[model samples]
Target: MAERRMMLRDPGLQPERTRLAWSRTAFSLTLFGLLCFRGWCRDGNLFYGVSALISGVALTAMLAGWHQRHGKQFLSLSLWSVGALLLLNSLRQVLA
Candidate 1:
């Protein structure tokens, strides 16, 4: 009988790719936040300002503790919250 062995590391650079993807996402969120701030400055919309603040805080938290066990959970929640905020803002703009 032959015993199977588990590999300690991924051979396909999955971890590196994942890290890069996350970095890109963080960069995108930063850009989105900046755009929101710009919108607030131009139109004085409180929602834009609040969205920018939330984006900044979420990005900070995600980056600060990404290696922790609960980091993914936090990331998921942050993404959903940001998405929801954007959706609500879009709906408001359309309705107004």
Candidate 2:
């Protein structure tokens, strides 16, 4: 009888890459939120304030799920929330 050998699959650095990507997204959201807050403070506009609040909430959600092994759902929802807020804000600006 002949012996059969099995090969193992390597995951490589995909996990690390994913973590780094998330970190970059978090950093971008933080910067955007800060800018929105600054705009609100300077112009006293409700839209800017609301946008800032949404960004903060999204960022918080991202951070809350950062250490979890299965946090993709949380991150996805947060990103979608931010996208929706941005779209609404853009439409408001265009209409006004």
Candidate 3:
């Protein structure tokens, strides 16, 4: 069986702050994706547009999972995945 990673009760204010920070990161990713999309539209580059769209979806999912109180493992996975996606997207835009 998979190891359980959830707590039975609230872990205090630190977790709340971390959760809020995750939401903020999600919001920032959404905004950055939009900006990238706009630039893609202007430049007629499919790569930029597609990467941004993926980032938006990833971040949105993270935010949703977070608010629903998904287990810490799930939250960590989603956050890291979104962060990596955004990082790769940024790198591709810069290097291409």
Candidate 4:
């Protein structure tokens, strides 16, 4: 009898690339939210500050989900929430 080692095959690189893309998107969104926060602090507009804060939190959750290879539902929900918050932020500006 001979001892043998079993190795798992590589699943290719596409998943890694997708994960990286998601991380980059989250990073960019976080930066944009920070800019909004700074503007809100300067001008005293609660809308910008609130929206940015919510978006930042959602983006952080999304990043965590992606990093952990969590279910798509969590990531999707966070992504959509971020988009909605950003939309509200823009509409508030236009309406003002």
Best by TM-score: 1
TM-score, prediction 3: 0.55
**Which residue runs does candidate 2 get wrong by more than 4 Å?**
1-9, 66-74
Clashes of each: 0, 0, 0, 0
Q: What order do candidates take by TM-score, descending?
A: 1, 2, 4, 3
| TM-scores of all predicted structures | 0.74, 0.67, 0.55, 0.60
lDDT of 1 by residue, 1-96 (tens): 133345365678987898898889889989988998998899988878888888887788768865355677776776677678778988999999
| Steric clash pairs (candidate 4) | none
> Candidate 3, residues 9-91: lDDT per residue as tens digits?
45688788987887787777778778768868898766667657666666666766744565456545644664575578679
Give the per-residue lDDT of model 2 (tens digit) for 1-96. 133334543578878887898899889989988998998999887767877887787788778875366556766776677668678888988999
- Local accuracy of candidate 4 as per-residue lDDT tens digits, 1-96: 133334544678879988788778777878878887897899887766776777677677775675466635665665576667668877987999
Tell me the spans in candidate 1 whose CA falls farther than 4 Å from its real position: 1-12
Worst 10 residues of 4 by lDDT: 1-10
| Residue 7 in model 2: lDDT | 50
Q: Which pairs clash inside model 3?
A: none
TM-score of 2: 0.67
Span of 10 residues, lowest total lDDT, candidate 1: 1-10
Best by lDDT: 1
